[model samples]
Target chain A: MNLIEILSYGFIQRALLAGTLIAVLCSVLGVFLVLRRLSLIGDGLAHVTFGSTAIALALQLYSAASLLVSLPVVLLASLGILKLTEKARLNGDAAIGIVSAVGISIGIMLASVGGGYNVDLLSYLFGNILSISYEEVIIAAGLFCVVMVLLWLFFHDLLAISFNEELARVSGVRTNLISAVLVMLTALSVVLAMKLVGIMLISSLLILPAVSALQLARSFRACIVLAALQGGCSVVAGIFVSFLTNLPTSAMIVMINLLFFCCSCGVRRLITIRNIG
Target chain B: MPVEIVATERLACGYREGYVLEDISFTVNAGDYVGIVGPNGSGKSTLVQALLGLVPISSGSARLFGSRCDNFSQWGRIGYLPQSLHLLNPIFPATVAETVALGLLSLKRFPRRLTRQDRETVETTLDVLGVYDIRSKLIGELSGGQQQRVLLARALVNDPELLILDEPTAALDPETRERFYHMIADVNRSRGVTVLLVTHDTGVIGQHASKMLYLDKRMLFYGGFDDFCHSPEMSSLFGEHSQHLMCHRH
Candidate 1:
């Protein structure tokens, strides 16, 4: 087969398209999540997403249906945690930590019991980028479009709310609605990205690019653009390295992101030193 | 009644254990500089949140702009600068202008981003605070004083009818504190913005505020600044060195 045919094979094409869209959606959400110190929340959402996937498998449903059904369920679950932390005496981080553990444990237990032994649990946990189908890509692409449109529409409000939620509310931004929208968007992105980035390494995709962009972006508009570029680069570069070296795409992507993170820090430090000198 | 910007009645709040503050009633009127003063752990912060409905009010009610405090759909018209903001995301790459612009983000719905009006307001507020030149500077690069101003200017960017600042000058040098105090006074006088600030700076309060709320277990004293400073209990609370605080304002 020629290069185009090899790349156009159902699974490979699926992986590429899904990865590109998922990367875009996630990196956008990542901007706020990392800035707001909710990187752990992104990680936690992955566990919750896995629980949904397992439930979908057990129920014999389409994976997309599973994601769709579970996205809100998991978001509601986390929102429940947030409200509890506010009303109860529990520490917020500790609460989310407990929820994450419970979710993954339940997912594994359910999957094992359901006897879907043919599907590699480990592969899904890390990411099954090569296993994606065109159907998955189409679904991911649609969600990415929705998120992008919404983000563009509320860019100013989202930026402000992310920076200072309470102040944003006081200044006339409907911060509560904005926050709920953010959480919902994050959940949706996590679901779409789970197949490409996989559950384990996905949070890296959700965070590193944002940090990298934050170091270099001189403006909010610049930050979003750079974050998108970094995300696209990481995914593309990771997939290429994986194909050439016969490594896992997900692992390669995360390593690439870490490399970007290091370079960003080094460059920023050098700039600071130069200015000082 | 030109419409009180903030009002609370018998508002009670504390941990699940019990109430640390209770039965406090007050109203913040236009151009009123109400300084909330109290010792540490007296639920000052809790009261601030309760007023905003961030923290649940265990008893009674609180209102902002004639609506219940917790409903944030109409929150675009209020201005709140929480204390302990120093414990916030300090290293996030936010410019002075971008940070302040956050305050006005809710005025418009999605699709249209920060408009010329929003940027103009942000720029004017920065200029008002004398930080216009540093508008593009990152928040992390600024000194403690400048960062504090950045946060304050963010609170002021919306030009809300009422500006509620929790310990607005708590983390600045005395000189910087004076500048901020004057800035606040200017906003109140020039723009007709109502002001309610929680502070431990009785000296600054004496110079600018029209009212004071002294709290320990509850609203121990809530009235004029003059009456608050002269009362023997209030006077004794400051100790023998209280006279120094009286002469602090330049």
Candidate 2:
């Protein structure tokens, strides 16, 4: 099939739309998480989703119904992690590590008990864009719109809290509420991105683009815009490359994102040298 | 009699571990430039935190602008500069103008858009602090003194009735520190803004502050600068250096 003919396939179209939507949403949210020093929370929540998905598979739930089961579970685990770090005096990293370890163990145990880990479970672990369906695409797109609208409405408050929590509180920004909202949004994005990038490599979607943008952008607004653009570009390009080379879609996307980060670093260094010269 | 801007009655506050400040009591009236001076670990920052309602008050009560601390919601009326701007992530991307604009976030509704008046306020503040030329530069690219001035501009952008600064001049050079004190004094005198400045540099603050608050885990003395110089507590706490530090030429 020619390039246009290959792209005309229904599965390919669904994969592109779903992948791009998840990429943009994750990148924008990633800017705030990266700035607030909570990038690792993405990894933690992704692992929780892995465990929840395993439970769904063990119950023989359908693909669409499985998201229903996993999303709420991930959100609760996200909030639990937040509470543990805030009230329990556990260090943030330690809290994430504890939750992630428990999640991975549960998933491993469930997979072992439920017929010794099938091909279906392996696809979720490594990501298979070819398996994306029309229904999942619609769900991902709907969530992308919701996240974008909410972020736009609360961008100022989010920026204030991300900059300094204490100062934001003193300024009457409702730091606690904003923090909860951010975590919940992150959980939703991680859960949705599970099929796009899978459990193990999901954080790369949430972190790499934002970090790369920060290296080159001069303002917070620029960082968000650039990160989203970078994420969308990487997702589309990675899908095309994966289609051509028959490689794992998630791994290819991550490799592309790493290339962007390296190029950003080089550009920053060049700018610094130019100024000095 | 002038209206009291801040009043704390026998306030005792501390972290979960132990009490850092105990039985602290003081009042700041309108237009008063009260400089709080203390050694490290003397709970100066902690007291500031308590006043701003960032720390829980273990005992007694504190009020701001005639409202209880817990009930006080007029945060826009108060400007606060934390001791360390270093708390901001150095790599977090923000322009000087955008950083200053955050000072006005509380004044607007969610999805806050800058009004013409807000823009004017930001510009005038940056100009006042002599940082308007670099308004578009990233905050991380500025020097220490420039960043301090930008932060000060942010604090002053809201036209606050009460200005609270905690160790604002810690990392500044001598000339910058002197200029900063002068700017603060100008605001207190010309704008009738009540000032509560926390610092360890007794000499510089003593030259500008009308009132002095000496603290060592508790209130040692709170009165006019002249009285602080003559007080027995000042002499005993600071020994011979009290007179030298407090008697510098204005």
Cα deviation at A81, candidate 2, in Å, is 1.4
Off by over 4 Å in 1: A1-12, A61-84, A87-89, A172-177, B1-3, B65-77, B109-112, B229-250
lDDT of 1 at A238: 82
For model 1 the local lDDT of residue A253 reads: 91
- Candidate 2: lDDT of A209? 98
Measured by DockQ, the strongest candidate is: 2
Q: Candidate 2 at residue A148, lDDT?
A: 89
TM-score of 2: 0.97
**For residues A144-190, what per-residue lDDT tens digits would candidate 2 score against the true structure?**
88998889888989999988888888777988789888999999999
> Candidate 2, A180: how far from true, in Å?
0.9
Report the C-alpha displacement of residue B125, candidate 2, in angstroms.
1.9
TM-score of each: 0.88, 0.97
**lDDT tens string, model 1, A19-77?**
87788778878988787767777788788888877877777766566666677767886
TM-score of 1: 0.88
Task: Mark the regions of model 2 whose C-alpha exceeds 4 Å error after superposition.
Answer: B240-242
Kindly give the stretch of ten consecutive residues in candidate 2 chain A with the minimal lDDT sum.
Answer: A115-124
